[model samples]
Target: MNHGPDDLSSTGEFDSDELALRRMLQQAVQEMEPRDGTLDHLRKAVPARRARKRQAVVGMAAAALFFGTAIPAVVHVSSTGTSANTSNAGHASQTQGGAGQGKEEEGGESTSGGSAGKPEDKGKGESKDADKGKSAGASTGASSGTDPSTSTAASAAVCTAVQLGTPTATTAVPDASGTVYGTFHITNGSTAACTVSGPGIVTPAAQGAADASKISALRHVSGDVASAGLPDPSQEVAQLLLQPGSSYDVKFAWVPTETCPTSEPSTDPSPDPTTSPDASSSEGSSTGGDTGTSTQLLTEDGTTDGSVLVTNTAEGGGPSVSTTVSNACAGVVYWTGLLTSS
Candidate 1:
């Protein structure tokens, strides 16, 4: 009873008691044993329980997502259905009102007819209705602002030679291809507007005064060499309308022959030997003492060669317009359809 606390902690009795408690706890733990397959069952059951909990969580989340989307879709469908029903109701009401108004009009017309029993009165009413119909038709036409038939007839009036002014032409210098570009301007000098239906007949004038063999062959073509700057013939209107003072153009190109024909030498006898001795001797020696045997090449100026005369006659018989297209040699002449001038 008088011993101190440190001296008690070193006593053999307290140490032996602690050792006994430890031994008993060890023995209890060693002696304990579960039933057969308890560990395996615990292992399987624990995982199965955790899996169930996970499945429950996933199911709850999926249900929440489904409801979240489904509620808005349901609401939208309901609103659309309501709007459609309202529109249908409104259209139905309008249709019913129109039908009722028609019925009322028919009733009023019947009542008025009953009041006016005379056959003459009925005929007068019909006449008035006819006049009203005519007036209505006229008002409709005025409202539309144009008559197709009248416009068509006005535009269809073809131009005659008397209505056309004197045609003028301008020719450009020949290109490397020997193609000369020119435009024949035809003016509508008449006061009234007229249409040119198509490209009129183009023909080479009868070889008058010029060599017949050297006349350029006239050919109607859409386009040809050096025609790039000219208007496209294919795009021309079928009926070209020309107002007063307005002019149209007919583009043409002249292609000269590749080679020119040589002219026969003059038939005049060699210079008289009795004339001046210097001139007679020079001319006689130059002529090789032959008369009319020398050949001379034709010049490309068309003055000595030959000129092409192009004549354009409007379709349906109109006074023809002619132009002298100078060509160095014989070749084809290309002409295009009527084109609106700039």
Candidate 2:
């Protein structure tokens, strides 16, 4: 009702000269400051999500170490499972007697028959002290590459020469390229001479021509022996020392990888892939490191029950494979780093 400022601009809107010229343009604005490096370029680009969670905890610790402890160390190519002179701290024998030395006598094992590969097999509760052990060359002779008589269709036979807790002497390896040449066996259970080596030979890697795992030692034998005796006439093990008596046959030999998946059923390929390069052991992992592979067991002989296995063969073309053993130790000083698949 007081309409004065130029008659209130003819009733349009108030503008006391444009409200004092917008308060002099908000007092001449000016206040910026915020550009040091923009937080150092996001802290140097953040290392791509902490490098993919440290490569997935190292690819699940290398996929549980080849599906867990190298399939119990390949289950048995004497495959490197455990008990090769596992060492109870007793350690005494090997005085220097060639054929079972002092003639033997210690404390446990003896009475085979069990785990021929599963005939619903029962027998494995005794081997700790089965009546003081002894026996060898139970005789059928042949087993250099295995052919007792040659009649394997399978229900048994991955390896069976059960005596239980002593056998394992012969030491003399050199192949897989180290080229030591001929004769390789160990652990010949002795209580007074030739102590306990229990296991020997290692050649557990093959399949080359550019893959490059290629290892060699052979003679691994150690099936968690609930028993392992027998080995005299110089082969050793008359209980030079390996308490609980003796029952051992932790033998060693393997050959399967000409692409070796073999459709999972074999009678005899018997070490001739061109000349037995056998004893395979490829086993790898590295997720964030970026490389991964899996396989743990491969055999060619066990000789009874069902003859231990898991296989598939095909390569160059590629598409047949197998190796899986989850876990099997049983308990105390037993070893079965065994193998048999030809």
Candidate 3:
């Protein structure tokens, strides 16, 4: 039989036996189809994944058959694949629904794999899946959650802190105001302290000084001056020493009072021709300082010694003063007056 290409068979087309088998298969398929509420339940429970795949396979099979490209073996496989895909989709949907709604309503329920693992492990997996959008099965180890990343960051921070130590403090201060800050580590053998004050080890910044209080403050900041004399705060000194092992600190900050300025010098001679009674005084002979020339002086003993008088006997009775002719030499500091307006 020499037929057209589309109609030609290998002289062994569908025999009676083959045709009967096909008819039986078609009847069985029709009988096995979902009935009553079964089709509705399956549609509600089936997921889009396998259902969509089933539809694709069936469409491909229909197109191939219409074009007369049917191969019996290929058709059998295609139909089987569609049925398996639809069944798997229904099962997947049911699992998803049970995990959530406990019941499949109009739409199928979703699942994060309930029966797939232990309840505890499944819960953790679901949580990770929700956060990362990854497969629940991927959440098996500690690295599954974002917490691992945070933990790594925290560890890095702690290591950095341990290596870098503490931050330094800085501040600016004026002449009268100053910032105080320092740090030192203590060890068993290191008991002595290197004392300092006002920025130097033993010296302090210079400022105006008044009474003992200000001086004491300076000493406190200056870390005690070095000296060999008595350690009396009452005495005046430039520097002092400190005891070992113990630290001392101090500061010298104060403003001084202003003194009057000296005027022009006079042309008058000192020790001028005063009382011609310069010969000698009768013991207790009504004697007193010539108020016109001599000036008053307070002594160390806090008493006024009229014997050691001074006079401003300048040429024009202007700015200068001089002491009397007694105790001229001996290492004593005598005070001379300079003329000042009252």
- How well is each residue in 235-283 modelled by candidate 1, as lDDT tens digits? 5545565666777777777676654545555688776667899876565
Clashing pairs in 1: none
Instruction: For candidate 3, write residues 182-257 as lDDT tens digits.
Output: 1111111122211111111211121111121222122221122211211233322222111122211121222122
| Candidate that scores best on lDDT | 1
User: Rank by lDDT, descending?
Assistant: 1, 3, 2
Candidates in order have lDDT scores of 0.64, 0.30, 0.32
Ranking by TM-score: 1, 2, 3
**lDDT (C-alpha) at residue 307 in model 1:** 61
Off by over 4 Å in 3: 1-70, 95-342
> Which 10 successive residues of model 2 have the least lDDT summed?
325-334
Stretches of candidate 1 exceeding 4 Å from the true structure: 1-156, 206-230, 264-267, 270-304
Ranked by lDDT, the better of candidates 1 and 2 is 1
* Model 1 / residue 118 / CA error / Å: 24
Question: Residue 191 deviation, candidate 1, in Å?
Answer: 1.0
Q: Write the per-residue lDDT of candidate 2 for residues 1-342, one digit (tens) a residue.
A: 565445656676866777566556645643545689977777776776688889999999999876877666577636343455443221222222112232322322221233122211222324323422322222212122222122213222122122122232232242342211112222212232112222322223232121223222232233311213312223433122222232223332222122223235557655556653433211122223343333233345421111112222111121222222111111111123321211
TM-score per candidate, chains pooled: 0.44, 0.15, 0.15
lDDT score, residue 97, model 2? 18
| Model 3: worst 10 consecutive residues (lDDT sum) | 333-342
